[model samples]
Target chain A: MRPGHEEIKDKLPEYISTGNIPDDVKEHLRSCDKCSQEAFLLQELNKVQVPEPGGLFFETLPQKVRASVRQKKKGFLFRFVPVFTLIALVVVTGYIYHTITPPLTEEELFTDPFAIQVFDLSGLSEDDIPPISVDIADDEIYLTEETSLYREFASLSSEEMEDLYEALEIKNRNGGVL
Target chain B: MDVKQTRYAEDLRLIEKYLGGDEYAVEELVMKYQRKVYSLAYRMTGDIEDSKDVTQKTFLQVFANIRGFRKKSSFYTWLYRIAMNTCLNHLKKKGNDTLELNESIAGSNGNALPALIKEERSSFIRGSLKKLPDRQKTAVTLRAYEELSLKETAEVMKCSEGAVKAHYHNGMKRLKEILSASADSPGRKGEGI
Candidate 1:
């Protein structure tokens, strides 16, 4: 109720605990009803007793706690099961995407000139191309110089080479056009 | 080591054992502090059932977050902190429920008349406590009910010692007023004297 009453009340518990109330606080408590009541209430609040649960409560509390903890752990795992499954599905899908054989793009086909390229035969007639048969017994037709195909072409006369080059140019043009 | 240091050591040992997968360590830890936690909860909730529930929830939380117990404060202080928070939340959930005099006085061990009288007084005290603001109730609960030192109360409360003093002083003032009002008002059940 006074300017210093709050300070005294704050110190009251400490004073009571140590059994060393300062003379000023003691004097104040003697005169101040508010502070006296506060002190008495604090003492009573501390002294008020609560009933203890029976021995069975204490005996069974741990088991109850343990059961609850175990239930919680199970709940945690259950809660995350779907998340783990989702992650696994994503990873498996990624691996499958990378592992599957992919269709060759035109760029890939063009990058390697010698690589096999699929032709659209739907527009071409069989009679549009001529085929010749080779005699397996012709020894002179064999590749005598195995090192280079160019060496065999080098042996051709200028006129023959000119005709062969023209034939190759025509084949390339037809392949692209078709 | 002093007695407190020894307690800290034992608590740490049990915590370590619990964390290390010793199942019985949990039982040991629970047994050690259940009474104190229940006592604090009983004061805050003023009912035996709510007290039991709060005490169990406190331990459940403590064990669940045991890995986060940084040992910055003693295990006892940390336990009180969890118990206090649980009590506050439980009280909020209860939301202005008044204490039943008969239920509040159930735990007496002796002569009926004196015990009933004491319980009546206690019931009035708990009713008065419920009227306090959360912080003031907490301050009084820690200082008066749990018997924590101001510093320990501050640690459990996560506040400065000055703040605890302020809350506690205000709480005591309010309690005196409430008790006085109860005494004067004949409609009020207990004298709280």
Candidate 2:
């Protein structure tokens, strides 16, 4: 049967601690078989003591095991330190390399005199010259058209061109703008 | 100093020394709190061996992470939190089912009936505790066994006082039911309830 007399039955443990049980509830507990049995059971349950673990148990943990555990922990740390250091070094080195290298400039690619020849075509338009088809065959210059000037110019090396320019400088002194 | 006062003073000194980076302070700290930690672990795990393992692991974790422990909480509270978590994780890994209570004490089975009954009850309580939801078990253990106040239990549980109260009430009610069932069982008659 549900104890409809009071809600204090549900809170019996708390009320028991404070010794403030109402007279009606106290009378119910004193007379009611079920509630009294439950109260006795709770009292017995409360008195159940947990056994303390043996005193010597903790003391019995071998010193060697403790040392080994300590050693294993130290070993893990020691093993990690060098790997961490290497990673840090690689990252720093990569950062420094990236920061120090300069970018490529356009002047570096275009400044070589050998890479281009400037033609004095001040009075010439794109249509004045015959279309000359030049082919490099067997490491020798080949022109599809048999032109004397083309043969002469192609036969001279870059050093020979410098020599011709020097000779033309002397000739230009004798005859200006020739 | 009186024995209790001297021990308290020593615990404080050890805490200060640990903060000061003395290596032995950790050892002293472990020595001081091992029983409390082990008992808590054992009560939570329901196995002496598992409790010992959990206790060791808890101390090692505490030692490693002590630097992160702010002084806002008491050292014991922080330590208990670590121990509780470690025990819970261990229980979870083992599948959080009911653990069998050992029939023999220290490999012997000739103890008195009342003592055996009490032992069985204690083991039942420990097993029942595992069956509880994590927060409820923690709140119940901290309040009942550790005798921490509701406020202190809340602080350790990282919950509001009302939550702790609810957990405690529900946990105790469940425990009473479990114990009552076990007491009425025919197999437990030898336990002399």
Candidate 3:
């Protein structure tokens, strides 16, 4: 075989089919028995019969393809919808956690420091307490105010109180008040 | 219009319908290309059920991303690319050791097919095919058996034309060697499983 026989032999089928074979390559096929055999072998290999695929191979494929597409699309939104829902749920949970929680009471806020102050060691005696004056005149004004409702009520007789109560009860028993 | 032009137009119409919210158009597109997609996947993967899975996966991906298609290539070209990718990805996930078939897989049917001899030869060819490197195998299956043009194969492969040429060359060369060697070997029967 020639030095470049492999390259020419590789292209032999294509060139022969296209009818543009050069003379030098033709001479190579003629002179090199090995190259000739390779070309012949390729032709024979091409002739090796490949049978049509068994079953309704072609006819069933389209339905299978459609079913597959439908299957994918069926879950297209389902795939991401849950993720969004989870995110929203997390955010709402966090918000409610912050907003609905009660504020700390003053006692609760000062518990640590106030605990020390609450157990005071200091005790004061009653003798150390300051004296305070009573204003009896101010207290007397309530009794002396002649036109006040309190004074008038205080002046009411026991019999007058019973008569007033009886009149009020009579008005209450009347369902015609409206 | 010519058949080529008509196919393109029809593909465009279906795509428009799908984009306009007619999901049934996706079914139409599937009906149009499912056989081609499945056959390509089956040829590349060499497994009937696996190829069906790949075909289903490819169409799902297609409709999922169909709106992104810019009509730069024919719809079939785009569909073929998705189908090829799905098959190759499926192959990768199954791993490189998966290239060799296991015993349980071959006898899996327990002689389900009526024509045992023909099934055996078919299995032999598939086993030999898996021995090719993935890209080369893809190129050989698409071009030789699937009858895709070099351009279409390149498009499906998402590679330069020269790369397709090289892949097909190396692939065909290796296939010839493998086929010839298998033919000469008495032990070839076990290789199918």
Clashing pairs in 1: none
What C-alpha lDDT, on a 0 to 100 scale, does residue B56 get in candidate 3?
78
Q: For residues B81-133, what per-residue lDDT tens digits would candidate 1 score against the true structure? A: 99999998888787856432233222332222222334356667777787678
Is model 1 an incorrect, acceptable, medium or high docking prediction?
A: acceptable
Q: How accurate is candidate 2 locally (lDDT)?
A: 0.65
Relative to the unseen true structure, what is the C-alpha lDDT of residue A167 in candidate 3, on a scale of 0 to 100?
78
DockQ of each: 0.24, 0.07, 0.12
Q: What's model 1's overall lDDT?
A: 0.78
Q: RMSD, each candidate, Å?
A: 13.9, 15.4, 20.5
Candidate numbers, best DockQ first, in rank order? 1, 3, 2
Candidate 3's displacement at residue A10, Å, is 9.3
Candidate 1: tens digits of C-alpha lDDT, residues A26-139: 889889876766566666776678888765888899999988887887898899999999999999999997679575679988897876756678987878755434445545
User: Which candidate number maximizes DockQ?
Assistant: 1
Highest lDDT scorer:
1
Residue A18 in candidate 1 has what lDDT? 52
Clashing pairs in 3: none
For candidate 3, write residues A88-163 as lDDT tens digits. Answer: 9999999997789776566876875543323333586666555443455655645556657776777789999888
